[model samples]
Target: MASFHLEEDEIEKGEETMGSEPEVDEDPSSSSATWGPPHQHGRRRVNNYSGGAVGLNINEAPHVNKDSTPFCVFMLYFARIIRLLVEETNRYYHQYLDELQDGPSPRPDMTDSEMFLFLGIIIQMGHDIRDRLKDYWSTAEQFAMPFYSNTMKRDRFLHILRFLHFADNNTETDRNADSYDRLWKIQTIFNTLNDAYEKYYNPSKHLAIDEIIVKFKGRVVFRQYIPKKHKRFGIKIFKICDATGYTYDMKVYLGKDRTRADQDVTATHATVRGLCRCIEGVGHKLYMDYFFSSPDLFEELMTKDITCCGTVRPNRKGLPDDFRRRQFRLKKGDIRVRVRWNFTALVWKDKRDVYILTNMHCPPAEGSFCDEHGNAIKPAIVADYNKHMGYVNKADRMANSYSISRRTWKWTNKLFFHFLDMTILNSFILLSSCDAKLSHREFHLALVRNMLEHAARGPPRPQRSRGRPPAVSSAISRLEEASRHHWPTSSTSRLRCRVLFV
Candidate 1:
């Protein structure tokens, strides 16, 4: 794709055109009707559907229970996914034992049913594994009764945790090096979940792409430290999410650029492009941050019928020189536009200099808003970018609120918990989309309860604490005698008195 710098004449024409249009107050609900700039005389036509096309049609969309009970929802939407995890886990467990040269031990191997129970307990534990396991084994109370399983002891559960593998060991070495190099142990499971994510639901037209940090402060080659993120050190994942925080696609960022062959393009552009490959030619509008925005990227996405709007860094290449130099000189609410054949860049003065680049929206014919001081106006593209770029942040906040993941030395294990968190988040999104009124906490609690009830026999009765039962008969006799003796004397004295002994 070719990129061009905006000339003086084009800038003048854009300003004159913007100034001549009549200003009309717009309602928030009608924002989608004028999402992008109006079609210009010589620009290529872009699709601006009010509600973007669905990824899957109604007939092809995954069926979710509209009126099922909570338990039924668990069975239909969640049980099978957990079952798959249990099966894969058990297979890997036995394979590890068989490979041991010391031969089979006296302990029996874990069954699929037992693995299911183990996972259910872990989900409800939400604490350090060792501490939680000790409590489950030692506590003698009604609250802990449901999690106790007679078939699986603490040692056995620990064994499963230590050797919990998602993919076959033999085939791990032979796996594709490009995508599965560092994360080979869990790559198969990751791919499986990714497939399910895309197949189950189609997101709306407006999508946001952003990076999420999975907390992992371990000795790993690919660990990242993003100072601005809440978790400063962890694995970074690039995600494409819809307006409702549904993750449509994701790509884990491994250390260096092993997958991409092009060296000239920055990794940010490559990550955005790769995550967007699925929605290409679908006329979906993408909103992003400064890290992933560039004129070249917008130009390339235009070819794929994808329109992008994002804040551009002033230092980024291809921005007009005058806009960069004179940005500080413009008064608040002052707006300037520079247009090429296919690309448009807007420089608006808000609190500071704000640069936005897009191919979808033209210079707004009339849309503008005043600041708090009524001194400056804001462009329509800036408004739209602010509206749609928050989905990824919302998702991150939701996932982190009730994260079940624990601290671990192994990055893969940390990542496994991250996936579990994502699964719960996705399930909440799915349930809410089906018009269910359950909150995130409610959905999770229901799933945990239903899974335990379905997978295990009713909670084992609490074992009574070992001690002699208290002899209450003697105390009862003494209390009765004392009351009888005091009743007569207290009646005549006009004073009420009673005695009890225990």
Candidate 2:
């Protein structure tokens, strides 16, 4: 684990824009005037990757704490974030009670134990799902779940969820029709969790940055529509996760208004920069897709002592115009390389052209062999990118496996669930990487069990359900509380006093 925020020396250098990086000769591959000593066919053949990859050592180096439990790891991230949840929820719940109720308060104010139990119930829902929540409380043979009923009343669960709030609504200025804050409601929670994510654990050097959809179809100004993705339309979250599926950092896409990168920087590039700020100058290796790969970025990262590799779009700036040559193409297992400064651009031919940019890998040893089906060799950079680029995807898959998320009309609510799921995923990763090797489902079960059981002994049971007449209330309450003699239900067998005076 490491500090969530970067200190003085680790802060990201000035944001890099193509215009600002000192210009070099025409990209080596852009020209054919290569009668040089070391350069090759309109390019150069060289490799200088000194930074060795470092991953978390579950039992030793990286996993500083060898003896860790699932609940302890869970608290590392949830302790602070839950406080925010408790405070705002209570504040908003009270405000809601005062505004909506017709007479005196109908329900007691929300308490900490009640809040935790509420969360435990929500977490339980993901592990065990029913068509309707009420079914968990049903007395019918198939529908009855004593576990759910014993945990909390279904109506009380629904009531707390109905008023669950992360931010106060009583005093709000900016979130309106004109100049609205898209993430105003859940902003505090998002930031608090993001901080915990960063500080909870230091990810391995091979980190990946990618976007995952929250699968929302609700009305929103900044909703994304990625046709290729399964959940193609929803809020997009750009996160950097390690090989273990630990989401180290994340930033929600808030459309144009929240775009705060350099003027010339593309939104995608800016996102990568923001997510990478924590690991800057740490000699980490970043793996990303074509959406974020570019020569300028590779070089910029190199300057910070970090190295990276990823697939790149041929049309990206700083690439040779004919980087993806049409007239001349290499056969299967053959590749062409171009070097500019410390960054290398490679094009390998398989079923189709694969363009890759990197400063972390050398070119593949040249050879002609069988097709991909035959498991022919590929450029080292290509293989490395393919291997390490799935960290974020892995994180997404695990989060969705036993998700606490639910369909909601409000984008904030949907995002809140996404955060909840990610937090649990991170905690699972943190614990599993150390001592607990529990499955994603099992970890959640244990987490929910501990959280509920810890706070499960709720306030003492009530003696009366409703008030009696004003004059007789006190006397009737005292008489009802008198337990010297018991009123028993009729039964076939009568109990004999077993206690003996000693």
> lDDT: which candidate is best?
2
TM-score of model number 2: 0.77
Worst lDDT 10-window in candidate 1: 13-22
lDDT of each: 0.64, 0.68
- Model 1 Cα lDDT, one tens digit per residue, 1-502: 1111221111221100000111234331242322223343143454754433443323434455545444554343344555555666667766765565443342444455565566666666653244455666765663355345553577767776776666666765644556658777778667777776776666888889877778888998889776655577889888999987877788887777666788778888888888887788767788877777877787678667688888776667666666556644666566666655545677776656677877667665433446465755546676677778888878877877777776678787788887777777776776676778898877776767666566566434234255433346644565577786653444534543333321
Q: Write the per-residue lDDT of candidate 2 for residues 136-168, one digit (tens) a residue.
A: 789999887788788888878887777778888
Query: For each candidate, C-alpha RMSD in Å?
Result: 18.9, 12.4
lDDT of 2 at 475: 48
- Number of colliding residue pairs in model 2: 0
> If scored against the real structure, what TM-score would every candidate get?
0.72, 0.77
